[model samples]
Structure formats: C-alpha cells, structure tokens
Target: MWRLRDKYAIAGVGYTAFSARSSVTVRDLALEACGGAMADAGLMPADIDGVVSFHFNDSVPAMAVATGLGLPGARYAIDYQAGGNAANLIVQTAAMAIEAGLATNILCYRAMNGRSGFRLGGGRELAAHGVTQYTAPYGWISYPQAMAMWCRRHMIEYGTTSEQLGAVAVTCRRNAALNDRAMQRQPITLDDHQASRMIVEPFHLLDICLETDGACAVLVTSAERARDLARTPVYIMGAAYGGGPNQGDDLFDAMRWPDHSHNYARYIADDLWASAGIGPDDVDVAEIYDCFTYSVIMQLEGLGFCAPGEGGAFVQAGRIDRDGALPVNTHGGLLSEAYIHGLNHVVEAVEQLRGQAGARQVDGAEIALTTAGAMTCGGAMVLRN
Candidate 1:
C-alpha cells in the first residue's frame, strides 16, 4: 500500500519569540518564522516553491508570506480557515505536495497575535450558525465553556478528579520552566491549581492554555533532500488528519455524538500507529496538544497510550513527566508554552527527535508523536530521527 512513511522529512523548524504581545504585525511574524526555517534548512527563499498555513482570520495568508519572502515563484499556495487542528494537517499537506512533485520544498507556518488581538478564549461573539445558534444564546460562546462540558462528562463517567487534572498542569509547568521560549515558566503545585479561580465547572485558570503572540514555521522536503540539509532529517513516519462524521462543518457536533469523554484521537490512533509501523510503546517523547489540562488526559486515552477512561490515572502516575516512561509536552505545550496554535508543538517534537531540546530533552529520544486539537477535528504525526 502507498504510504507517506519515511518519504518526506521536516528539514528545518523555526519560531519567533513567543510573547503576550508582539510589536509587529502578524505578517511580519510569518515572514520572520519562514525566513528562519529556510535559513535553518540552509535553503534560500528562491528554493521554496510551496507555502501553506492555516488560521481563523487571525493570521496572514500563505500568499502574503510567500510574497514577503520574495519567493522566485510559488507553485502552490493555500491558507485554510482553521485553528489548532490544522497544525499537522498543514505539514501532511506539504508532504503530500512534495511527494506529488508539485513542490520541492514546502514552507508551512502559523502566525497570530492571539493575545494582543483576537483572543480565542475571550468573549468575542461567535456567528450564530449551526451549533452556536442553539448554545451561544445560553452563554456557551467560548471554547472553555464548551470543552468544560466534555471534562465534566469524563469526570462523571470515569471518576476523573480535579487533582488528576492538576497533575497535568503542574507537570507541563515544570517542563515549561526549562523552556526559555515558554510564556508561563514558573512551576505550580496541585494546591495552586485547586486554589486558582475556576473558569467553568471543572476547569481552573491554570488548566487552560496560554494566549500568546507569536509564529512558528517548518520546512518539508523529500527525505533524500533532507539528509543533505543543514539540520538532521526528522522523517515523517506517519500522519493522519480528520474526525468523526459531521465534525468538519461544526465542531460542537461532538456534543450530540455518542462519546462525550473521547476526542478525535480515538478514531485516528489506529491509522496513525499503522502508518508509522509502531505502537505507543515506541514513542520516546510526546507533544500532545494541551489546550486544557483535560485535553492531555483525553488525548492520552484516545491515542491508545492507555485504555479508555484511564487517562486521568495515566497522567497522575507521573508517566508523562520528563523522566517518566513517556515524557509529554516537554516544551511546556500550549498550557505553559505560548500558543502559536499547535505548530509550536510540531517544532518541539522536531527538536526532541533531533536531540536539540536542551534542558528538558528526553534521553536517547528517537521517535516522537505530536498532535493538534483534541475535542472534535484534529491531526497527528509521528516523527523519527
């Protein structure tokens, strides 16, 4: 069967300093990250032929970034109107394009002024459309409130506790303390998580991810070309992007779906592992998307690291610590690190596979799993050195 395994590699990864606010425009941030990725790969702008990015009307278009970089000619360019879910999808698309011979080297990126401009967790009015038409009127407008329902259901069904969720927050903060690029570096204890003001019924202020202004970019090329690049080739062993039925049109459709405790990862894990030809035991490090502390738990379960309803316990057992059997979110993740959407998670996975993650680097890391989004639609990829 045809597969993307070991065919394309992420030749380089780059990012701008994450901050609560940036002095520059989102366009400039995109340019800077793209340029850095190109430089990291030892490729000039003229060598880039494809550009891809995704955003929710909060970032620049791929064409704009391509123009800014002064690409001699862009054969393929697209910008999907999406959020964190598109992080791995963009990379997958770039790999497919390279495999199809449509582009030699593709630059994928996401840049946003999330904190300074359009705050995802803020009270911005959502379009009263499909699911929002029914829920928004009842003040179910923001992501925290919507996702809190999932967390609450998991608690009732599996007896997941606030303390278990706190473990995720504390562990991620500890990892972030070693990441100079992370926004929230100070470590927090479970007591601190319990004491923090609650956002929704089951979520604390510490449980939610950070909103930061920054950008991240990566360069994808054939494995052959990657081996000759400036950086070590981090091969894309497996990739999957999608969700259960009807999730594409409305994410909140998950509410009516049968499984309230699980995310899209439940459906995609098999394909991800099959494509990579490895199981959860083979992953040396993980960068699971942690838009919320509960997200990490849910994904850990959905991705087959443990059986369903056991995620809370899995996290509480210290298995996700930096020195644990499977270190997760080693660069702090979105919870402690800046939310450049989930592209930064991809960058962290690349760094781990390359053995470039400094203080929090997992020992002898050879394979990494990076995921984006959790609740409804999402994407994931397995990378190896």
Candidate 2:
C-alpha cells in the first residue's frame, strides 16, 4: 500500500456559497472558498507552500496565494488536468507533494463563473470536437441526449425502464431537499420526474445537472497535524484514476464501449481497493458525479456497486436513499447542488466522512467514495474519519 494513503488527510474543505452569480468574480470566489477552508483548518495562507490547479482554472491558486492570500513562491505547482476529474486529481497531487516533503501544506482548488458568465451552449472550440461536430451534429446535441443514447441502448439490451431512470433523479432531488446548500431544494416524486418533459428520449430536464458559478477548495496536511486541527479530519485512505483504452475512434472499439469505449470507474475502483485494501462493500456513502442522472446508474455498475444489469433494479429499490444500505450523492450532488464543475461532491464526501453533513448526514458514515468524469475519465478515493 502507498504510504500517502494514510500519510495525508483532508483537514479542511471549503466552497463559496454556491450561486449563479456568486456576487464575486472568479478570483475573489476562489479566495473566499480557499479562505474558508484555511480558517476551518486553523491555518492562514502563509501556511501553504504547494498548490495544484487546472490548466484552465480562471482563479489560479498561486496567483491568489500571492495577491490576496500571500504565500511565498510554491515549492510545486501542478497544472496536471482540467476536467470533471479535477477533484480527485487535486487530492492525489496534494498527497504526492506532501509525501515528497516538497511542502508540509498543500492546497487544491477550482473556481469558475462559467454559469452566470457563459451559457452552457456549445463553445466554439467544442463545436469542432466529436461531442458536437461528429456525434452532436448527427443529433446528439446535449450531453443528456448523448447519455440517453447510451442509456437507451442499455435498456434495449438489458430491459431497463424509465422508472428506474426516474428513480435516480428522484433520489438525487430528495437528497437536495435535505441539503441547505443545494440550489434546487425542491423535491420531486416518481410521478413528477416521469411527468417532466424529455430533453432526450429517456432523460428529462430534471435529470441534468445545474450550471452555476462558484469555487471550492480543500486543504491537505500531514495526517498527524490534521488530527490536531479544529474539526474532524477525513483521512485520504486511497485515490486512483483511469481512462478507458483508445487507439483511434474505431467502430469495433465503439461497439465494445457503446457508452464511451471503456470502463473508467471499474479500473479506478480496482486501483482504490488495491491501494487502500478496502472493497466496495466497506463504503458507506457515494458522492459519484451526476453530470447526468444515467451517469450515476452507469457508475453503479462500473464501480462494483451492483451487477451491470442490476444497476437499474438496485436504484429503483430505494437502496440509494439516505436510509438505504448505501446512500449516494447525499449532498444533492451536481444534479441538484450547484455544479461548480463537480468539486462540491468531493467536499460533500469529506463532510459525510467527518460527520458534519448536518441534515443530510449519513449515520455512522465512516467510509465514503466519489468519482468524476474526464471524457471516459474516472477516479475514486476512500475516506475515513
């Protein structure tokens, strides 16, 4: 097992109150959340010496560290990735930085005003990519539509139903109702979900995630120092990531994948379990990304939560509710929570492990896991108090 697994803990997790406007620019937004996280951990900006950020992050950490919250030049700065998978990558990078003794304190974050700033319509750059140029122009317009094609294909092959899909949306919406920070606090029933208009053949608008402008940051410190901090310290037991294999975008590979050409979560899940020596059954809650409702269902199978075909039945049985055996996306998730591009899910998972999730707290949640998408990108982490 990697020593970093138990060497570092997430001493602090922070986010600006998620909003469409945030009443602040992207840089100020990051500073607010990063400040909150530092205060929560009983530290000041000067305490940090290493930073990890996305290549496209509007609110650069080292810049923030210098301007408002000053830190001397960082010992290490990583622009390793910029995708939904950023949350996990940040944690992993922080652990490595700490393990190498490059810095005693590591900060990782993401901030965006993309929502109040820009509509979720096709970017000029994306128009040239396959999600639009090839697949979308051929009628796969939105992500929900693209995902619905995959979900419908699964249903055709495995007999999944609309109710099963609706259950995923309902559970996430209900989870939102339990969370004050959730943007969409309103709850929905099976009938409400079913009655919702279809954006895609099998997906309703309710199945899609909200676009919001905000920022989230996490503080990583030595596990021992974390234990001495102000609040619960959720230990990063393990973290790992993977993307499905690809050569060219061949028809045979497409046939094998149909969804995305690979099983990212399955690979990452195996990585986490092997490194942490813990299996899926040991996890108490899941904060897997919900960019689309069906993504959660697909992750259930890929992450070993249930058998491939049993995913629909698994969710439909209320097994993912707060009281259920394995509650998931308990902080409303990206679907209902403001999607600061999926960073909030990481914060929520840490909160769940720390027993600070307030109204949405899972009982005795000692272990939690989460994932984010990067093309077919996926990653998992095991956290425990």
Candidate number achieving the greatest lDDT relative to the actual structure: 1
lDDT for each candidate structure: 0.90, 0.76
What is the C-alpha local distance difference test score of candidate 1? 0.90
After best superposition, candidate 2 residue 12: deviation in angstroms? Answer: 0.6
Q: Give the clash count for each candidate.
A: 0, 1
191-267 per-residue lDDT for model 2 (tens digits): 98888887778778777788888888889888998988888888888888766655124211233453541246755
How many Å off is the CA of 119 in candidate 1?
A: 1.2
Residue pairs clashing in model 1 are none
- Per-model TM-score versus the true fold: 0.98, 0.91
The local lDDT score (0 to 100) that residue 204 gets in candidate 2 is 81
Worst 10 residues of 2 by lDDT: 247-256
Candidate 2 clashes between residue pairs 3 or more apart in a chain or in different chains: 374-377
lDDT of 1 at 353: 87
Error of 2 at 253 (Å): 12
What's the true lDDT of residue 71 in model 1? 95
